[model samples]
Target: MPGDAARPHQASLPPAPRNGLVPSLERRRLQAYLLFVAMDGFILLASFSAIAAAYLGPGGDFAGVRQGAEPAFLLLPLFLTIALYNGTYSRAGLTDWRQAGAKAIAALAISAALLNFFAFFAKMNAEFSRVVFTAGIVLTGAVIVAMRRFLARRLTARWGRGAVNRLVIQAGGPKFSLPDSIHIDAREHGLRPDRADPASLNRLSQYLRNMDQIVVSSSRENRAAWAEVLKGTGLHGEVIDEATRAIGAVGVVKHDDIGMSSLLVSNGHLGLRARAMKRVFDLTISLAALIALSPVMMLTAAAIKLQDGGPIFFRQRRMGRGNGFFAIYKFRSMREDDSDGARSASRDDERITPVGRFIRRTSIDELPQLINVVKGDMSLVGPRPHALGSRAGEKLFWQVDRKYWQRHGLRPGITGLAQVRGFRGATDTEGDLSSRLDADLEYLNGWSLMRDVRILLRTVTVLVHERAF
Candidate 1:
């Protein structure tokens, strides 16, 4: 090959087996399990206490009779089972505060419902106060979420970075591999670079001098050559199987491999029933929103007309599913000019009128998009629709990557997961775009009516914060 010599010699030094020296994977897993058990216990305790306070309060004899202990014992196990079945324990590290809080709330709700159902069937419903049950669930959920946040902060601060695997690579090819793929895979495994080098072995040596472990990703044929090159460097050497490397690095089993298939057979498409329900919900909600916000929309139109001599409604052709184009509607938040039509509005952009800024920040400008939702061109929750020609530098929104349009598989949303997560507004970098897509895909895979409601709630909170324009 013309570029064989130019191919930088790379080495993979697999991490040393910490065996008895450091915390083992089993230990970590056990610790995580225990943490969840403790959390469930605490939640159950809080729930019991709250219920007692609300129902068998100072006036009630059952408050001090230890009668609630039996119920707590019964509910704690059920709560744990529900939380486990919901993938709460397994996904603890991957969960954000919003996700954790939502799951805790959901698990508590399910447990409460089951408990109440049993009570009702046994004709013991009168034994407990409905207010007590409701208050208990609410208070327990709040306390659990607060505790989780505290624990999460501590965990992230103490171990998030340290728990990640460290890898150093020496490129030994004419063309260096894409950093994006490496970063993506690394992020999945919580493995990240302390530092990266694309050039000389000396740089890699200098970088890894202080690090205890490193992994090199390069061709199998170059493994021996790399090992021989660093024979006396006092660093261990190992070869990374490129096929398995990507899979293992990302902790995803390759579909073609039987090992992975056996472990994850339950991986199924989002259910058809769920999709149908979502569509129905979207239609009903969008229609209601359009009807309710019509007056506000009319007022916004008048405001736009009075402030800027531009069109009241801004409609632009945005890329929808299957590369189809649809005119997305929004209140006119920018000037009627070529610049506004051609480019994304940036912070302090001259095209944005003062009223436009306020509307954009408050997301009142997006209220008109409910019409688009009602028209079936969009949904109340999904990926935010971008103009067909919108791009970052030379990369058009759709042209950036394949996953960019994967989000378009569902209807574009007026207030998407991305917007609620503060990834809204101008996406000037690939990182911003990638994060937005990630949030969108997360929503797609985990869409539920409850999730929609939560997103709406968070959207209000984000609007109030006004951190992102």
Candidate 2:
């Protein structure tokens, strides 16, 4: 810890709800987002329909006009999906009309290319009216951009310039404030960064319930603890410490109005757009895998159940993204009575039942975790999460390296770069943990959608590794 100054402890008290004064705008924001999306879709459809009518109305066949406008119907969903991922409907877009319009146009262009690509492959390009589609796309882009600007103006008039709720906490530090943000003194609120105090943590959580962003201005001694506390909350957290550059701040936000800058310490590896893409990929893959492997999962469950009348699924709390704990699900591999939940299994462990032995080795025991992935607790590709009790040699995983906590900067995955690179199995030594940590950091540093696909493809080959025990 860089700054380790002690502060006087205040009597613990629960954080009072701020919703009464701040009337949570979450619902209103959602409604605005939906309105933006609907308006975009409507404009797109109208543009295509008008173009089609102008091009083919002389034929006097309403069916022909509808058929000519089919491209818009196909393009609508593609454009919306891309727009959603690109943040066209995000809070930033809502507040900044320029961002909304730019993203919307970019999404429409990509969608058009994709639609054309699909049509070419399917050999249906001849069926679509080129004149209608080309003109429709142009019109749609212009209309959507204008619509977004108009919507932003209307929303701003209604809700003010700050589209998202921001809260700033001054914790015994120089005053740092932002316009359109709620400011409160930490000491006055009886808030302290005490990891040992569950009541204090709960109060902090309550204070942050609906906030989109949280900024803490803490004295040098308390920066590290505040950073840790913010990490577990999974929110976009910043600490007003210029020294954070040494500890790997993702980015910095300067507030000229207050003559202060905050270090963004807890922003996740992916931005909102990248997160949207990753989440979509996670859902698609997990749902498809669950459907494809349902039979395998059922049979495995039956075998484990019939082995000795024990529980079929083994559930344990594992660290997730943002340092939060989640119950990871795995098919029970070891006998219920003799299982050592805290220790990693050795080769040919006697505690592993016959059925458990087969599934664990083949990685079939991990199938149930697809449910966890679908539930948004895990991903298809990321650093493998370790049990809290998991260790390398005699020391716990985090104890082996201080940077170990950073491995959890992203959501834990079913298969990671380390696993595909042969870093799987029980960590028998510190190097084993280090190798995986290094790989995890590498993955986080250079994350891309294509790299995730590559890791997943590579994972298939190592599913039945010898070290899985």
Candidate 3:
């Protein structure tokens, strides 16, 4: 009954005669939601068992299951209600794991406080160990947060491509064709905006009605007219400037006169406190790491010297935060004369000494960058710095079409999300560099101390497994 009205033209057609539109209502999305609910139930049960075992003397069976049935029943519904109130189910609400974990912890804290108050009022606080309830709060919250992250990643990975929905764009102008230009242009941005004829407005409207979302792009002069046309068809749409849409869809924002203005007004600005906290975190972590890894750095320097009669350390001028040039420090992993401009190092680089190869593979060659981190020229986690004029030869690299220098917004890092994700070596093409930049932007947009810690932990795991160079 809820989505019956939302169904398109089903009432006009003879539905299998028994259940009109009922089967259509039970779509994959509905099934996914149901699956999520079941998963949440399983997480709750598993978490309760774990907490009981940890705090309830290990042998305290659920013999009082019937006696506690009413309380448990009330608690589950109440917890879900609180989660809903916190916007845990909303799109754009729980994207980051840190936020999701915080929300779960907050929800559990409130629920526990309320449950305890209820127990106190009912004079049954003595019946259960407070420790058991505390453990349940922590365990259940952790499971829910982790499961939510797992589900989010699965959904993003599956739906992030043009797999679930198809977008239809209707653009009529002297400069643009219906779908061909849109298809060619949008593909670069990982979008597939199919073209629809303006004359076929009815078909376009029907398509929009069935699609998950719709976006409209037109010249500034024609936006109002297009908006009216789309609204008349009873469909919601976003009107973006045709030029801006074209450029942004390709994921390239130039930092020129107009581009800089747009970015300044755009929502990409991280506020002052975030900037300050990030800087403080960089300083603290880098200083501590430099102190801790001093011995390793010394041994690396000695090893490089013993292996070859070359400089013990390598220093290359690299672009840092705000496009400032700084000399990046590394344990000299290749012969000094091997350097030929800003070429990327290959796995089997002939100039790499045997000792250098081992250090590079294990990432010990990057240890000296901790000094750069302490010197405030770099961060513990940010975009990896690139050498000046690094893309002189490759054709694909020439068409990078990105704000490559925007990576200088934060200090260059010793290790970053991109590096840990195996995008660290031999970025010989535009596609590879673009992917790395995307990961860097993702990190910048969602930077937090917890995220930094997680990245470090993951970096250690990758190091142990020799996953990257």
Candidate 4:
């Protein structure tokens, strides 16, 4: 049980992503959103380079006009950051070519306007050639937007070939059918989810590893069983009550409207304004940290490399916001070929290298996660990200408490209220995690800018906690 894998196979309304939609480079392997940022930035820079070369010729006419496109690099990160907020990097946002193009262009224009606004305020607009900047930026934005639209069409066209997401339904309230995009495997004809026995539920659990979108009816008898089965399985679900006329919204469903007959459930989380403020806070603090801690990070990297001639960074796949998966970065604190990365390290774990132990104790190992914070995968002050297979002494964290996931309502953080309050380290029992969740819920309920600052200030005291093995 300590080494058991996660389940709740991810299945959306349509079938899972088809093979052809992904590029040869990305075939089979999922690409992180940052890959899009890097690729698009390259495309933009290349377009600018071409335009600059053509206008200025092989001669160095640009050196006098702009002193080398220094502004471009600054602008690229800003544009990409804005694009992130505009949903250009979102999975749902990229599904539609037209919509993606519009969002990208709009973000690009806003970024350019802001750059010029800053330049004008600094009285530095005259340093660059207006013609080159205008032509290059406009062409770059158009080209980048067009390329993404092409990618979108390539991805969406795969579904046109009848390849869509598959669903395994066990509900028996009323036989519902979906479009061609979803293929249902209703194995049980009259199995009422509300009355499902443990044997049936256990059977369903086994198959859940390969299915998408699990749903269970909310009956007094089945509620706890459903929660237990779903817990720590990495599968989110809906509690379908018998009063529900339809299990899900069918034809003519108004956009985002909760209907009386709809079965859609709500787990209240951060509001939009709070989310926006959180993003701003993360970006600002991470940028400052990167600038402030560059030297320390470099020294740490060198130390790790010289220790065993092994990789400096250890990458572990962790769960992110909205139940999505992301690869997190940390300094290598264990043997390069260690067998178990998912398990928590004990006080005398022999796997730790001398340099690794020092860095881990100093919390220097977590510095690379500043990149995660910058990328919006994490927050500065929130719950810490956990590995997929992370568990307590013998049980997974989600199994420890029913409210474990409610903490995930916000993005995982580098330092949280729990860590500041001295709740860091391995959880040998359910109570250990329950105590941490109590602190987490308290932070979420009383969230404030000053509270975040105080928690951040308090985080320093727990950097060398007894849990840092």
Best lDDT among the predictions, by candidate number: 2
* Shift in Å, residue 338, candidate 1: 5.6
RMSD of each: 18.7, 6.4, 20.4, 11.7
Better of 1 and 3 by lDDT: 1
Candidate 1 structure quality by residue, lDDT tens digits, 354-441 = 8888888778888877878767777787788776556665566544654454465466788889888788767687777888888987
What is residue 89's positional error in candidate 4, in angstroms? 24
Which ranges of candidate 4 are over 4 A from the true structure? 1-172, 175-238, 242-265, 336-342
- Model 3 lDDT on a 0 to 1 scale: 0.55
Candidate 1's displacement at residue 380, Å, is 0.4
lDDT of 2 at 113: 98
Screening candidate 4 with a backbone cut-off below 3 angstroms (N, C-alpha, C), the clashing residue pairs are: 11-212, 14-165, 15-164, 15-165, 15-166, 16-165, 383-413
Candidate 4, residue 118: lDDT: 92
Candidate achieving higher TM-score, 1 or 3? 3
Clashing residue pairs found in predicted model 3: none
Candidate 3 wrong stretches, greater than 4 Å: 1-269, 337-341, 396-398, 464-469
Clashes of each: 8, 1, 0, 7
**366-404: candidate 2 lDDT, tens digit per residue:** 988898899988999999877777878998776787667
Q: Which stretches of candidate 1 lie over 4 Å from their true place?
A: 1-271, 337-342, 464-469
| lDDT, candidate 4, 248-365, per-residue tens | 3122212132222223332224543456677888899899999999999999999988878989989876655433456788999999543324577888888899998898888999
Report RMSD for candidate 2. 6.4
Score residue 411 of candidate 2 by CA lDDT: 84
What lDDT would each prediction earn against the true structure?
A: 0.57, 0.81, 0.55, 0.62
